[model samples]
Target: MKTRSKIEDEYWGALERLKIGKTKVVDTKSTRFRITKDAVGREAGRGKGYVRYERYPLLCEAIADAEVARKKNGPVTPSSNAKIEQQKALKQKAISDYNQLKQAYDMLMTEYLNVVRRNFELETGLAEVKNVKIIRMPSVR
Candidate 1:
């Protein structure tokens, strides 16, 4: 149990480096930036494309951290049925929260895609239209 707790602690620590809102620049393209674990919307630029981290990773990290804490100094040990039930409840809520976050990310991505697509179409259409002008000559004095 102690070993398991240590591993979970390490896993959680690693995940902290991958949290949402964290920004990193693309190694190859200085102008391109990647936002890790975005709960908002995916964005792309330069040579890069839109990408997002799935919520499952975050959920796993949260669960592992909680387990580590519970093992170290839980209110009760596994010998009690209530402690087991409490752990189970915590796991269920974590899963539910992950699902909700995933749904929100998906919705945001959909809106982002639609807006980009529409803008591209409009720009293309405008580009194809030929430029025209109407000019009237002023009378010479």
Candidate 2:
């Protein structure tokens, strides 16, 4: 088992390598960044086997630093602009979709309330009719 200090040293080393462009950050499926040794094509934080990078506080700090470095050094490209535009369009579409769904829900709720009101009125009318029928019943001698 490795000591905490050794693991922290590894993370700091990875961060230094990332700053110098020797290591690159790869995004995981979970949207977390992982530093990779570009020359070896393996992850930096992993010492011997699988290492959960989030377990160490230093590793998370190192990843955050690396991400900041990447953003600072990365060049703005045409593709990045296109991605921004795509995100904006998606956001607009989602807002429009939510508005439409909200309108439909409001209309349905109104109709439902009207139905319930009508049902209650009918039920009360039926009960009144039953009371009248009972009052009109002839007494048996």
Candidate 3:
């Protein structure tokens, strides 16, 4: 089981992205962002929570300001912004790890399939070294 790190927050908090319906200036033409409906309705579902569009930048700024303030104080608790940044970093790392694991799984599956095919071929006498070798004592000389 995965264990939390020293810096990891006891509670894993999250920010929700808006599901956009139309083309936006910031996103690619195919993709867009918007506040989801269920979230707007405050639906109590896992990972269904949402935050205002404006709050993100404000939180980021607060986190940055906290860093500046850190020099004055020895070690203060992280601001909301800093926690958000840490959450994002952890998410990105998780995604990277998932991709690598998926790639490895795919490769191993392919190799297994190939081995099965070769075994089938061998059993059906369709592979190389088709005939079994046998030794005779030359009619007892």
The C-alpha lDDT values of all candidates are 0.49, 0.61, 0.45
The sequence of per-residue lDDT tens digits that candidate 1 reaches over residues 76-95 is: 33567888898999999999
lDDT by residue (tens digit), candidate 2, 29-140: 3333344333112345454433344466555555566667666766655698899999999999999999999999999999999999998797778778855432335889
Against the true structure, candidate 2 reaches a TM-score of: 0.40
Alpha-carbon shift of residue 139 in model 2 (angstroms): 38
Candidate 3 ranges beyond 4 A from true positions:
1-74, 126-141
> Which number leads on TM-score?
2
TM-score against truth, every candidate: 0.37, 0.40, 0.37
| lDDT, candidate 1, at 108 | 100
On lDDT, the stronger of 1 and 3 is 1
Q: Which residue pairs come into collision in candidate 1?
A: none
Clashing pairs in 2: none
| Candidates 1 and 2 compared by lDDT, better number | 2
TM for candidate 3 is 0.37
In model 1, what is the error at residue 91, expressed in angstroms?
0.5
